[model samples]
Target: MVFPTGSLVNLIAIVLGSCAGMLLGNRLPERVRYIVFCGLGLATLVIGMQMALKTQNPLILVFSILLGGITGELLQIERGLNSLGERLKKRLKSNNLRFVDGFVSATLLFVIGSMAILGPFDEALRGDRTLLYTKSILDCFASVPLAASFGSGVLFSAVPVFLYQGALTLFAGVLQPMLTPAMMNEIIATGGLMILGIALGLLDVKRIPLSNLLPSLVYAGVLSYFFM
Candidate 1:
């Protein structure tokens, strides 16, 4: 179970970006911070749109969302995550620590896309770092704005990204056999739609319960397994 070097590099960049953002956030004016957020929102939209266009199976995507949303709702991922963040915040007891919003938002922003999952598989099995490297660059830039808006809590998100992608990459050998090209494409497309929702939320166009839809990615994979 060996993880790719790209995952490790991505993790480092995220941590560094968050730290840099936190350090510089205090010096940035409110207007600048607001503009950064807007920039992030637009970037997210562009990425999501591009990813969405890659899919040919709309039915799979729709069904994946339906089943995945149900699973996520049952699992109570949003509530559970908020509870965990609240507990951590309380334990730390730092008035400056607003952990839940930043941590959750940043984690989703970094992890809920096609590249996040696909990158690990690509790197671990194929020794290709193109997607992961690109994702890391995007994450680094995104973190700057996120940290400015959310404060130090954004830095903590690196923990989840590391754990999630590291585990995926480590197990890439086992999963590689089961994952096919079409399956991977469907999963990426599903994640792209989710990322679009997140972008809309960031832009304040609509507030989507993205956490509740997290199971959709799993559903997409399963659906892909059956169909692809």
Candidate 2:
């Protein structure tokens, strides 16, 4: 069994970054935060596009997305995520208006990227922490500005980071033998589409219920296994 040491490191990084941001947050200009956020959006958009373009079978991608979207809608995954965040905010008895926003936004940002997906896979399959280590550095810096903007709620995002990435790492360990190169590509492509939507939301172009599309990655893998 593979231990999620990388995710542990990521969790620690987020905690440290959040604490540092809370200390220096007031010192950083809002304009600086805004510009940094926009930069992250642009970079995420490019990365999403690059990952999406790796699809070997467009038909499989389309069907996977369609099925996954429908499944996610039925499951109400986005609503559940929001409700969870809101509940956490309420339990904390906090007055921060952006608590849920911060929690959800930071969770998405940390969870949606290619590094978030591939890093765990690499670690589980080959015991290589290189990708996850790199992601830890990136996420650490990203959380600084996010925590500065969102306050203490950004710190809580680390919980989901641990859960999601750790789950992926465990599942990858079990599924390593079954996963084909094509299936992996399809899964990544599906996640890429979700990331693209997330980028658009960050850029203020549109808000997509990316959490609702989470099942798409599963569908992509299933379809790729049989069809590809």
Candidate 3:
């Protein structure tokens, strides 16, 4: 499997979007920021609803959530994340900036979706960059609103995006034998549903503790192993 140059492209987009959003964010008024946030919320909700309808197996979804939530809770991902954020804030001396929210939200948005996982696999296996290209575009757009409200935190998300996707692409070469097409599709669909929940949280329509379900990806992979 070959690595796609698209990962580099995606990184470039995130940096560009963050810089643009930060520059423009300073000029925007509070009202404008509020409106943008509201718009993002709505967009998130729509995205969530759309993805939530993709799953054909409700049982997988149910068990995935249960198992994943337990694992995440035990791992204390949320707390660890908050602690990391607090350290960053203290180091930067930006305690009032709410960097944690932006970092966590943007990271989740960029990483927990079907495209984020599948794009790397496609790129490595087929030298196809289409999925990643599309995802990069969406992330670029999403960064605008996020930057408007969250300052440089939205831009910082690019770091995790790079690490997460880059690692997946790198690992794809070794993992190829385990990932069949049917398995990949199921994983994508499962990830899509998770992204839907993330979208809902972003929209403020529902505050789903998505971090607690991070293990669903693993569960999906396990299920795929048996079913595929």
Give the alpha carbon lDDT tens digit for every residue of 1-228 in model 2: 689999999999999988887777788888887887798789889888998998999988889888988998999998999899889988999887877777887898788777888899999988999999999898888788778778878899999999999998989967777888899899888878878887897788998888888888889999999997
Candidate 1 lDDT at 201 equals 78
108-187, model 1: which lDDT tens digit per residue? 88998888888898888888889989988888888888887787677778878888888888998998898778888888
* Candidate 2 whole-model C-alpha lDDT, 0 to 1: 0.86
lDDT to native, each model: 0.83, 0.86, 0.76
TM-score of 1: 0.93
Can you give the TM-score per candidate against the true fold? Answer: 0.93, 0.92, 0.89
Q: What lDDT score goes with residue 161 in model 1?
A: 87
Residue 43 lDDT (model 2): 86
Error of 2 at 169 (Å): 2.7
Model 2 Cα shift for residue 17 (angstroms): 2.2
- State the displacement of the C-alpha of residue 217, model 3, in Å, after optimal TM-score superposition: 1.0
